[model samples]
Target: MKKLACTLIFILLSCHLFAQDETHPFTIRGLIYDEKTNERLEGAVVSSGDNASAMSDKTGFFQLRLDRKAEKLKVKLVGYEEKNLVIDFDDESEVKLIIRLTPEPILLQGVTVTGEHFTEEPVVNSYSIHPGDLSKVPQFIEADAFRAFQALPGVTTAADMSSQISVRGGNYDETLVFLDGIPVYNPYHLVGVFSMFNSDILQNERLYMSNYPVSYGGALSSVLELNSKQGNNERIKGSAALGLASAKIALDGPLWGGNFLISGRRTYFDFLTRMIMGIRFPYYFYDLYSKYVYPLSKNNLLTVSAFYSRDALGLDDDKVFVAQKEIPNWGNLFLNFSDEYFLKEKSSVELKAFMSRASLGVNTQVFFTDYYHQMGTTDTTTVNNYIEDFTARLTFNSHPDGQALAVGLEAKREAIHYDWNIDETDLNGMYIHPLESLFFDFAPSQYSYSGDEFYLNAFVTDKVTISPVSELTAGLRGSYIKNLKTFLLLPSFSFSYNFLPNLQVHLSYGRYFQNTYSLKERKTEAVFTPFMATFFPEDKENIPYSDHYASGLVLSDIFSEKTSLEVEGYFKDRNNLA
Candidate 1:
């Protein structure tokens, strides 16, 4: 009986010691904004004590968790004044705040600073572009997103007039583009002269050339992610611009305790060409965008976004006397709905659904006449192509201690349809010259093809800090293709070391895969047609994949705070060309 009493007393003492060792951390959530303009600020750094730090997201939201013993917080960002706050919180407590930072004027040797500015972070092989800086570059009488990307290192274009970028020796179709966490197919307009994205509506743009996070997949070369701005929460505002090539308008305001934005742009190139050069170019393009944001609560939000773009080109019998006419048109439509809920100050869950459709059509007619026989023949052709995609994705993010963990799952369904009809008469003796005879084809054919593909992807990524000056990121992605009946696994890793306050080095390696293929005729000039095809693994021996290796050194504030330089070298090995 005495021994049993002693055992019970020791058990009670052990339980008390375990409770004393457990620590309940405090969480703080906040939004950072510009003090005078009330605009949300992204990329701001928020640090609590010494071990906890977070950067503001595209929405200007930031979250930090700290131990009970922490007492101070600091916020810093480029072009803004640094601010410090006193923290007073108990165990298991939560706090919310709104911080406003004032802008600071930059002076370089007594000269007012103007032009492009750059800032460097710790992410490896990653770059970001601001919308304000895009307007400074000259491109087709308007700022272009893709054109701006082409100016970056490791990115090259096929031709001077083409905006299709090939990154690190990868093909044009190897790059993946995303807008608001949704994939975008056929993102070009004006025969690859410009991108469909409107510069005025963009909030954030990021490019990952190598070792990108596992949250994104299904691409072999690179990733370009773009986010649209949330409308003004305080007041209503509108802007309109009229340029030589296009006209655009934007409206944004608060609605029903939320925010809304609408923007549209249209080009009048055909009309301008007819008036100035007496040439009926017969080509025009337009795009429309809308976004709605509803803040359900302090930590929950809902977003709905829609986009539409159209391009039409026609050449009737007005300009050519040979009785020839061709009309080609293409367009894209996208819709997305997303919901975000915060489970804790440093953890969140997001659910998103999106649909995208792309279409192409072509109609052509040609006629031939024989003077000796006084006879005429006609050739007509029609082609129609359509592609549609439906996708759903769920992502979860958590920050425990100083490390970050993210996991996501995505499902996609894609459908494609292509049909063409061609009817031509024998015109071998109708044309006088051999060159003219080549235009009068003698062929009659019809073909139709359809396909459906389903994809499932899951990924997990972790960011760990091994020391104060070094950080590492490890990720893995798994994907399954139903049509191909194949499974793929991709792995990514990156390491960054800050050797000095203003100098850093980074290394990264990753494996990537792609299931879609873009087919075009091997010609000297660019061709805009409906010739894209999908790969079926059952019929193919190998799937498309690429391995990337890159290393870079970044120098920040070499001469001044506004001056920064990045030099990177990369090697890529691609197999099973798409």
Candidate 2:
């Protein structure tokens, strides 16, 4: 019996070896580029005749393993002609080829590339904004993202003159804005006419109405995140536009084996009014944006971005009595650095360092002249508020088979300063205090506050595929505030089930916390003078938290080929109102 068993094992081993010899491991690796421009193309599909396929990454690199029986490979990309190459295998197991595809005019007209598809399940209460669609909407002066958002459901603007929007009954200040993975406290120019983001430099925008992921914190209402363009690596390109209120120019080109983009926008209405008419338009706004991208290697990338925007209004008239000079300005500045390293087995690590400052203030001087036209009794009033944030974060993400995990550590420090000295009620016949007109039953006086707070946060999230038609996501976050000497844990959960091929239901719950609270006297929210809740002793137990419960139903491909319907109900319980 022992001899018979040994003979069977030897026969099975010989058969396995013979099968291995019949099929050799074959792999193809290459980069895809444009034939005319020599620019790298991302999202191109490469496939072998035997059904093996791979997609090009952002860097236009792809790798595919195919069966030995496969003879030829084909590449297809939108707006480009299909390319075919014959296989010429040598003794080596791997083959490298640089492929180039020619651009072709699409036969179909009015074929827009909207990212939304009815067949795929999406996050609850989330919307993706295509940068190209912004131009289709009517523009007040130029394309404004915030203005475009007003047409979306659950979003409402304050007025036609203002671009500020409220989401689902939440205050405008409750919304958190991010640019290039960094937080932006103030993302407006001229208080609301135009957003700080330049449409020419924007690549993508996403809005999360509610029940957002724990990866983003310190917000109770919504999140708006924007990503900038990566620039052209092959050749130099520039564009300029003239508008009624503003003028903008953008330039992008290859630099130092990488790419760079720079853009600037300034309202020329001040100059036009002065040049055409002899009137002095003292109010104008300008903003500048720049970014640089470099690839350290095939799997590593480095990026740096900076943004600045300012709105300045100056008035000085010595020709009239009671000569007065007033200057009111506000703006935001931020610098961000990010490094991403891709690992094996569909994993990556991201490290980010960011610095940002938001400042708003006004300085006014009034002079009383004597009967002889001699200047006397000069009074000066100043009000200034600034918030500076320094942050460093490291995040790791892995997707293995049917599950995904994300863990991150973030350290943030914020320094807030407020100063004001006002002796009178009016400045050049206008309200001096920013909120004096909004709040009916309030009085403004000397007030000052200066302090700093440090926060350490750790978060972990897991997404698991329960079955072919269901998914579950759960997350936990822990935060420690040094000034408050407190530690808190927050948990979130989400579940989605496909009732049918075209219908889906999603349920989610989350607990959110906010350390920064606006200081206002009336029911209305103030745009400036934000204070940390930790500064007040009474806020120890009332750290300003909210519990969110939401459920949504999605119907895809029900009405039309490219149409979808979504319905959602949500409830929010908020505490510790400032």
lDDT of 2 by residue, 255-298 (tens): 99888999999998778888999787878989999989898987
Candidate 2 has which clashing residue pairs, if any? Answer: none
Q: What is the lDDT of residue 118 in candidate 1?
A: 51
**Estimated TM-score for each candidate:** 0.85, 0.82
Clashes of each: 0, 0
Give the per-residue lDDT of model 1 (tens digit) for 1-578. 23433543453344334323335466778989877556678889998776678888767888876566457889998778999998766554777789999988544684443334355464687667764667766676678777777777788876777667777777777788898887777788876677888888997687887667789887888898888887777788889998766899999888899889999999977778899999877679999999998989988989999999988866444322233344667778999999998766466789999999887776766564465544366766576777788999888776655567777778889887867665634422222222111111221256576888898877777788788888888887778787667677788998889899888898888998876665432231223322243433334356778898999888988777767788888888888773
RMSD of each: 8.2, 9.0
The stretch of ten residues in a row with the least summed lDDT in candidate 1 is 434-443
Candidate 2 segments whose C-alpha is farther than 4 A from its true place: 1-121, 317-326, 368-379, 431-443, 520-538
Candidate 1 local distance difference test against the native: 0.73
Model 2 weakest lDDT span, ten residues long? 528-537
